[model samples]
Target: MAKYGIIRMQKFHKDAITGIQKHNQREGENSKNKDIDSTRTMFNYDFVNEDKIKYHEEIKKMTATRVKRKIRNDAVLVAEFFVSASPEYMHAMSPDEQRKYFEAALDHISGKYGQQNILYATVHNDESTPHMHVGFVPITEDRRLAAKDYFHGKTKIRRIQDDFHNYMNKRGYDIERGEPSELQHKSVHEFKKQEREKELKQLEQQVAHKEKEIQRMDSFVELKKAPPVEIRSEKRIEELCIQPIEIEAAKTVRGSKVKVEETDFHELLSFSKELQQTLAAEHERTNALSREIDRYQKENKALKHDLKETKQELQVYVAHQDGEVEKAKKRMREKLVHDFSAEQKENVKDEVKRELDKQYEAHISSLSDDLTIEKQKHEKTKKELVQANKMNDSLTKMNIDYIENYVPKEELDKANKEVDELRKENKTLKAWKEKALNWIDKHVEKIKQVSFFQHVGGIQKRNKRQDQEIER
Candidate 1:
């Protein structure tokens, strides 16, 4: 019976796809753990995006419905479908039939699931038995994502098995379920495993039986040699023989028959010697066979252990690789978002720059107009100060003429005091007008600098500085 074990691939493993690709494409030809000629690509997927980063992008794109902008990082990367049986099951069919069996099996799986879910389907012929390794993403037909869903309950797995078998059988492959004993209930996989174990146990029993037979033969050999040890003395043996010891049909060590009165005694001695020699050879052969079986069993166990360890390491390595790929992808995405933000900021900055420039130009123009008004006001004030000074000078002249000409002393003093007061007030007005003119010149220079910067790249430079700050 053919069996298929559906296994979930660990999330984010680099080896998940890399190793399969190597096996499927025969890339590890010279490596010690090469999968050379072990796999033939029954199907290929162009979706993996030879480029690792791009592959992830493709997955995200294809699964966009299930995987939104924010998807789980620990989503399953792959699932393995191991389909196999003993070599006899596969070799029973012709090459064309074998092809059909695998093709149909995969077709059913793909059809049952979604075709987009399957990544690769490879037929492996390099091991003890012909089998296939299929990799797929755990995506459901309705575009839902969940790796742990399909193999959750017995019903689903059974349906999968039945459907697979149904597909294969319908396509002319004589695949069927194995029979279980009346008192026993077990899965096909378990049954196959127990059957193999039973075969091994039987071989072990055979080895033990051979060892027991060897022991029995050894005991017989020892019994044949017991007569030599039982012979108490040579004198007694001669007396018992009643005459000279004669050997007949008794081969000596030199393969020559000897004549003697005690022919039976010679024969017993010769037989004991031959049996001892035979026993030595038989014991060595039996030990050798036992050692061979032991060694075979030990090597088989070691191979199994090594294979398990290698698989574990492969998974670990792939996981590490996946981390790296994810990290790389993360870097790219961050850079992309960063670049987008920067472009947006640049656009905003441009808009702000235009607005700032417009406001600056309007402000400078307003400042210029105010400066012009202030300058005109200062000129008018200066002219008024000059007129006041001139008027004060004429009053002083007129006061002097009055004081020196024909006025009373008291009246003259009063006029002089009034004229002095008018002169002081005019001087204060001149100082205040000069201060106002200096303030207006200072403000005008500031407005001109503002206008200059507005026309130059000062606004842009300031914006760039702010942008740099924002980036930091």
Candidate 2:
């Protein structure tokens, strides 16, 4: 079988980030895809980042500084690149080789859209196919968040596949490129429907064939119900025997013996004997036919029971599959609705924030203009006041006596009392100063007397030392 390297890209808006994280990271329950084998889930690994990457946070971090403007709610926050090869190709490779294959694919994506843009490169081994789920922030080289810039048109999409295939081939993978997605790709629902239809058709054919066989057997039994050839021959002989006797009776007188030829009598005797043998053979054949019919009927009944059970089993299986499909659809529908609702809310919030920012900026600008005007007016008033002061100064520095002549007597008395209190404080400070000086003088006299005594004692000790030296 020809093996192909497969690469598919799916865009996820900001609102869908959480769901993508849940699916790619295998968070929560495995309700999304039944193919997930939890036993093999431990083998799942990230080829890019070893650490568990929170997709929402990673996208936010990528766009926080780069994307200056408020992000649109419908904007593609992340693009997951599904990288895998055909089952034959993947199964043929060793585990280490598979990891290298994924790593090479990651390098291709990272090279195209900087390694920093990769949020996560998780390879899931639990699913039916071993594929890498790469989360990428679609940030352009100019530091702008735009998924369309990289993956927008059909031409670009095709080029993406071409490049990936070429890149893988060059790296020695030797895998064929997959068919055009538009031509060969089928939705999960359509694929399942086709498979189900095929199974049901085969079952129908089986049942129809069995029914035809039963019908044919029933026809054979009905045909067998007629008497055998031997029995038929016996009936013909009896008719012949009666017809000859009737002809002879017409010729003979009443109550007279119908005299027949000896040959005819012998012939009649043989016919009677043959008739007895035919009847006995027919009786045996009839019994055998009845037994065969009974066996066929039993077999036919069994076949019909089997067909009915098969149909019932098929019905139950179909019901279960349908229920699972409906549940998946319901979950998908609810998730879509939630994502849409969240996107709409985020869009509304962003729009409101933008409007508010504009209004605030305008308000601040207006206030700044008004403040500037007020500052200018104040400056002018200040200049005028400076000139008035200059003129007043030139007119006369207000004579101190003239200004004092208007003083209230009560205020003057208050000022006089403050001066009197200050004088009392000054007198008290003088007394404390005199006491401090007298204490300093007494301590200085005591210090001088002790120094003089020490000097006398030193002279006496020197004289004693000189006397002792003279004695020695």
Candidate 3:
């Protein structure tokens, strides 16, 4: 029973002002501008209410404190309203009647929103539908925006829309409650449009690429034909010289006593020899050129094959891109049609978070276990090293004790015999003792020079320091 209409408004000043002015000028000069008189129309109307200005100023002041300066100045206030009018009411109205209705609606909304200084409100009836594009400056008397304070809560926008609808209904404009289905439909429409544009762009690019490839192939074919012209020219020159020789022969007297001039004979013979040489050289050149041409043709054929293969690959790539585009469109359409409620979305988010947390915990637990195992292995290896050092120290101490205090009977007997031999050969215990002490001192010094002290008891710490000092 009602005719539906959508309304939208935004704050646009500097650049928007320039664009709007230009557009309005163009529209005013157009012949079709008169057609709009048959439909409802509304234009800029001055709002001089002081109370409205004060209300806007208050909101602006609040916004200035919380909103960034750059964004605040550049920000646009967008408002959309959906209204429905009875068919009878719409059909009964004249163009002027419809225009007045829109003007009244605009005035009512401006007053309700307390937007006294706003400008540039326009109604459009370009489609089977009607809508409005309203523009206004965001600045207030205090030269600040109050967006943050005025629309702080999520419900504020809804409240504004409701209030505007109520105001419009009160002012005799038919208004309708919005349906969720319409919003969904609108979203789907916009999504489809975007998908179509994307697909079009991909197709255009593929066409352009194919066109370039064709151009390149044409150029290659042209290059291949270029050398045949020179060969044709050489053949033409030989034919021209043969034609002159035939004419001269026809003019000569028949065989009985044809006395040829010596100079003429020499010239003819010379011409024959030169012709033979020229033909021989030309034959050789033609053979060489033929070989070269054959080689080039073979290369060209291979290149053409490669180009064909490349073109095939390009075709496949284009097909793949097209498939991807189709797949993306299908996915987009599915997403658009599949409606998920807020609760369902929230549940999905929670489930994903829980799964991620569980996986993260499992991974961290595994890492900690690995770290624990490595730590235990490190401690065991350290303990084993300490125990091995203790065993080595015990063995070294035993060796030292044996060397310092005990001697085997066989070794002692051998040593005594060697001493007696030495005495018989030289004759003095003092000399033998001196030699033995010297050998003992040398052996001790050598043992000390070696790293054996590092494994011996009581000398381990000093040996470790000496080793460390040497390393340094």
lDDT of each: 0.56, 0.71, 0.49
Predicted structure 2, TM vs. truth: 0.45
Clashes of each: 10, 0, 1
lDDT string for model 3 (52-75, tens) is 123234335544564455543334
Higher-TM-score candidate of 1 and 2: 2
lDDT for residue 48 in candidate 2, whole number 0-100: 67
List model 2 lDDT by residue over 289-400, tens digit each: 7788888878888888888888886786677668777876886787577556565788899999998788766655644554454456445645654565465444333333
Model 1 spans with C-alpha error above 4 angstroms: 1-69, 178-472
Best by TM-score: 2
Winner on lDDT between 2 and 3 is: 2
Give per-model TM-scores: 0.35, 0.45, 0.34
Which candidate do you rate higher for lDDT, 1 or 2?
A: 2
Q: Write the number of the candidate with greater lDDT, choosing between 1 and 3.
A: 1
**lDDT for residue 226 in candidate 2, whole number 0-100:** 69
Clashing pairs in 3: 63-146
